[model samples]
Target: MPSQVEVMVKALSRLLGWIYTFCWSASFYPQPIYNLRRRSTKGLAIDFAAINVLGFICYMLYAASFLYSPLIRKQYAARNPISPDPTVRFNDLAFAVHAVILSIIVYSQFWPQIWGFRVSRYQHVSWPVAGLFWGCLLAILILTVVVVTQSPDGGSDPAYWAWIDVLYGLSYEKVLITIVKYCPQAWVNYKRKSTVGWSISQILLDLAGGVLSLAQLIIDASFQDDWSGVTGNPLKFLLGNVTILFDLVFVVQHYILYKSSGDGEDDNKAPDPRTPLLPEEQALQR
Candidate 1:
């Protein structure tokens, strides 16, 4: 029932939503990769690395469900709301293959512990518990895909795919935990009156991403109950809105940190270049 232009706009909207949802790598890859290259782990939390390597599994599975799941269109006026056209079956298969490959990248982050591992032992995970869950999901996912694809019914249920997404979201809980721990360590380092081990750049980018994504989610959620694709998804509305608010805390904290660092720099006394006056200084002056 939706017009051509409307459909295209809505489709584009949804595409952007999906893109932002998987923007985890965009958030993580830059700093971590840079740190690894420079070997300057300063201001980089080891826990973030460990949890991140482990968290990739969750993110990848999430990416899998997202990339593979059928999208129900929100229409202008329709009893059954969806585009009548058949989604490409083969494309799903191919994308699913790529998902499997990405999963390997996720799983490979957790292998035999050797110094060659980019993550330090202090920062690397001792137990890849999150990694294991993602690995299992990946295994089950392949089997599920093969069977479902071969079956009479093409894999088309959003509900079925939602489980993987659920797991994926759940996996981020540990990432939050790791970040929480790292934040305190960050605070402690600065408590001595210097932003000694903090990277304001990282926090700034995080704030920027969080804010924009928050707007995106608000747009998505405002339409959830509408069932009209034009409005967007309501669940996205709730989660995205909440995230925007909570992320503000970090923004404030980082701003305060920036100011404090300036104060610390100013408070540091210059080296005393003046030579000490000897006991005979009074006689010399006379």
Candidate 2:
């Protein structure tokens, strides 16, 4: 039997969890919509989409394994002996699955044949960026093979523990991917001096999600009086904060620095938004 205060706190935590899940999941929609209406992915970074798809896939793996695998849960308990509160919630798993689907949709928009959208010739992901995504995928593939080969038996053997470690490593990989994924988009916005193709709605929703996510973690940890719930899962904590920082960067790029001017609006329908501004055209804007 729980006390009244305990019940209320648990209820509040659940509410926050759902709200942030909705926010983060819904955040994926605006970009595809924006691209559809614009009929172009001119200012959107291909690298951003590529990296985002991979990141969410990793997150899905992490959440699903933790929630479904008793062995993995055992591994978590072994690693973190102190904090015993729930780290991965239903909402977290839901968000991860939703994000992975939406991220794939968004990434598909980058290709001309898939969505039949026009993209500027200049709008291509650099070789290094492509290499980065492939490199990450290869690492995940190799580790997956190791986990499969090493954990043939279901017992709590060393090989089984190694598989658990790989699952846990995916969580950290997601955090790293989140940190890197934003860079290309931010750089694109800076280079173009605009955020015309990028969706600010996505950023706003992501910010809401990130803030609520961090708040929910704090509340749950406090309620359990087990700070290890937050501290032990440092990657999750770091992911929320890192997402918030990049969302802020995008907000500033969209709202503060490169806000649209009526006279020089970046036409969404333009076949090539990457066309360089002539000296006279640049002078007039100044």
Candidate 3:
């Protein structure tokens, strides 16, 4: 158990964590939106999209299983006090829907690149089906998910199956994918000693959010007497805040190198793929 002053500091830590996280969420759009409008993914890393797909799939599982989760039911009842019935918990189905939608769109993000091992990419699939399928799925998924997660017990640990689903399903293949697909690209970029262009703001925010999350962990440790990640929910307890520090540091390293070295763009830039590859760029598939 932490002392009085420690508790206060922990509150501040949570506040900071949430602030940065929300900022990160807000930041998600601008870069992608900009990329779409500009029709260029110049500075964007494919790993980001891949990880997001994994996260959404995890969210889907996280949201769908809440109704059956006894731990969640208990927590929700405790928080609400008024609505203790199981029927009140029926609204917990939205998360699964969102997860599916997010997964679909996440695939769409890379669809152009991967859509065609066959024909030209633009001719691969009907745009309408792809778009509408994801849009509807996301809408239904989000509504139900929000109803549950925000209902006082939203952040409760996942059910056992949900835990397993997320752990195995959302294994970020970004780093591995990067190694396989982009390693050669990275080597070429390194030879030129620059990123053909990776989005600066996105990576920067990813780093910041990771740091803020770590700070939140430290604060939680400072205030909580038990300080055990070992609750009924072992995954959240054991590995919930995992990899955040490394993520932050990794992003910082990239940002600093890019900042100091100046843009890798040349005076006569003629759309050479090798032009923007960074000397240090490699293995971000995770």
Candidate 4:
């Protein structure tokens, strides 16, 4: 029988897991809402959305691996037969799947706005090209996972090296994806000297989710002594922290540093009578 403390910990872990799942899932929507309201994706990076989709896909795979990996499932069953499922709840899977869908919606918003910006050269790469590149990379990763996990030697043992290969490879891919996912948008914001089109609400929600996720990890580590929950998947440990850091940076940029910036705001401002207006501005004034 589990101790009272252990039971309490398990309950707390489940509660935190659901909360974190909801927060993380909901966080993906604010940016899309911001884009739709503004009818612009200026200051937002398409690459960020692309990479976000890939990252979420990798995370989903990692989560699903817990369900399918016999080694992991067996360990969980041995440890706690009553609730032996190692997989995250279906709700968590829904959250991850929704995030990916939201990312695609956000990615779709980029092109329409980019078309409106009459610049000599587009700042970001072509969307289709970027999409293809990421698609190919994801395909390669899937193939590698299938090949390794299907090996005869790998199937012979739950603790086979190939199992570790799949687990760690997906985990590391998630880490890499998370590390680079925010860079494009951050760079754009830096170059533009503002985070105008980006939603502050999105950052706030993401920060909330990240903090909660980290707390969930702490709860697991404290109650279960599941260091492997983190060490085995350092990305899972680091993702929330890194996201919080970047979200804070974005908050500072949007609210503190660019508080007085006229870049995004100027889009709605009336044309100055004293200054000659561009053709587009003249049409808008009429």
Comparison by lDDT, 2 against 3, better one: 2
Alpha carbon lDDT at 14, candidate 2 = 93
The Cα local distance difference test for each model comes to: 0.41, 0.80, 0.42, 0.67
Q: Cα RMSDs of all predictions? A: 10.5, 4.3, 11.5, 5.5
lDDT of each residue in 36-131, candidate 4, tens digit only: 666666667767776777777767777776656677666545544444444344545666777778877776666655434322245366565376
lDDT of 3 by residue, 146-209 (tens): 5455555453533312232222222222222222322332333344444434444544564565
Could you tell me the TM-score of candidate 4? 0.76
* Lowest lDDT block of 10, candidate 2: 261-270
Residue 172 CA displacement from its true place in model 4, Å = 1.3
Q: Of the candidates shown, which would achieve the greatest TM-score relative to the real structure? A: 2
The sequence of per-residue lDDT tens digits that candidate 1 reaches over residues 133-224 is 45555755665565466544453344344233343343344334334434543553445344433444444444454454455444433434
In model 2, residue pairs whose N, Cα or C atoms come closer than 3 Å (at least 3 residues apart or on different chains), thus clashing, are none
Per-residue error (Å), model 4, residue 32: 1.2
Model 3: CA > 4 A from native: 1-10, 42-48, 59-68, 72-107, 112-192, 230-286
TM-score of candidate 3 versus the correct structure, residues matched by position: 0.47
Estimated TM-score for each candidate:
0.48, 0.86, 0.47, 0.76
lDDT of 2 by residue, 1-286 (tens): 9999999998998999999999998899988888888788877898888888888888888878778888677766776667643477888999999999988998888789998999888767788777877887787778777766767663354436366667657777788889888998899889878777788888999999999999989998888788888865665688899999999988877778887521112354344467666466899999
